[model samples]
Target: MKRLYHWPLDPAGRLVRLALGERGEAFETLESPPWSPHPDISRLAHGAVAPAIVDLKTEPRMFACGTRAICEHLAETGDGTALLPESAADRAEARRLWAWVEAACEEVTDTLLTERVMQWVRRDRQPDSARLRRGAHALRGRLTFMNGMVEINGYLAGRQVSLADLAAAAHLSAYDYFGDVEWDAVPDLKEWYARLKSRPSFRPLLADRLKAVRPVAHYADLDF
Candidate 1:
């Protein structure tokens, strides 16, 4: 059995989970909160981080740390649906957009999600209003850009589902868990998200919940 270490709300971790689910790979999951990661993670070849995977089926035990490495590894090894496109050009486009989604959402995660995690999960500090405001501003900009892309191309890269869609959806779903997304402001993106949410691969994420923190009412509602 394969073992995966991840944080429930981490976009990178969520992306890896979605990729694994999409590929129909079964694996055991161990939660490794960002504030207090699993000790084994620090002993890995790569620096400590959630979303790391250890393929126990391999001869010497293959290990992959971080989203890019893990996701690409799964794409190469798994035999279900292809996450990356077939054509070189399309693959390049998907990769470019996938990278863009992570880079673009960095601010939102660093600010808003960080504040929430600190305040609620860790109970370490008070919520920072400035960070929350900044994150909200950045999220709106990203939502508008994504909405435009979906409105024109139906998907982030093209018609076919790709890594870009999964990456974007993973990030958006994290924010949506906290009801941070204003779906009314982006109808096209909202519709797109609803479709993604209805997929079988998304069920696990929809069921994820922190100890004392509850998700939005519509977080698990596919129709919403």
Candidate 2:
């Protein structure tokens, strides 16, 4: 058995989950919010962050932290379709876009998603309008760029699904959970997302729900 510590809404966590799910690997999930991680996380040297994984099946055990470490480990060990492309050039392009998605979405997550989580989950503050606006503005720019890429290449890195597509979808899915993504504004990207949403690996994320917060109606709708 393998165990995963993650926050449902964290894009990095979602990326790991997607990779694991795509590989058809079963893992027991333990929720670990960034503000207050699971106590067991302190025991593993490389499991300090959410999205960490521990392979209980291994004799000496194996642990990995963060998206890069976890996803790469799974890609290497699992007997499923590779998340990274086979061609060297395509693999490099996928890695580049994977890094780019995280960098680009950092602002949106720090602002919009953080504010939403603070306001609803923490329930200790009001939503910051200024931060929300800033996040939305940044999100629009990212969506536009992604839309162009999908329009030209069918997927972020190429015709086949790759880490780039999964990474971008993970980030965008988090935003979409809050109804923050303006799908109409980026038609090509929206179409691409619909295809991703229909995947079996994406079902668990669509079903995620916070205690006091409800997702938007279209969050789980594959057609939307």
Cα-based TM-score, every candidate: 0.98, 0.97
Query: What would you estimate as the lDDT of candidate 2?
Result: 0.91
Q: What is the lDDT of candidate 1?
A: 0.91
Cα lDDT of model 2 by residue, 143-178, tens digit: 999999999989999998888899999999999888
- Score residue 209 of candidate 2 by CA lDDT: 92
The positional error of residue 76 in candidate 1, measured at the CA in angstroms, is: 1.4
Error of 1 at 177 (Å): 1.0
- On a 0 to 1 TM-score scale, where does candidate 2 land against the true structure? 0.97
TM-score of 1: 0.98
Q: Please give the RMSD of candidate 2 to the true structure.
A: 1.1
Query: Each candidate: how many clashes?
Result: 0, 0
**Local lDDT at 57 for model 2:** 90
Error of 1 at 185 (Å): 0.5
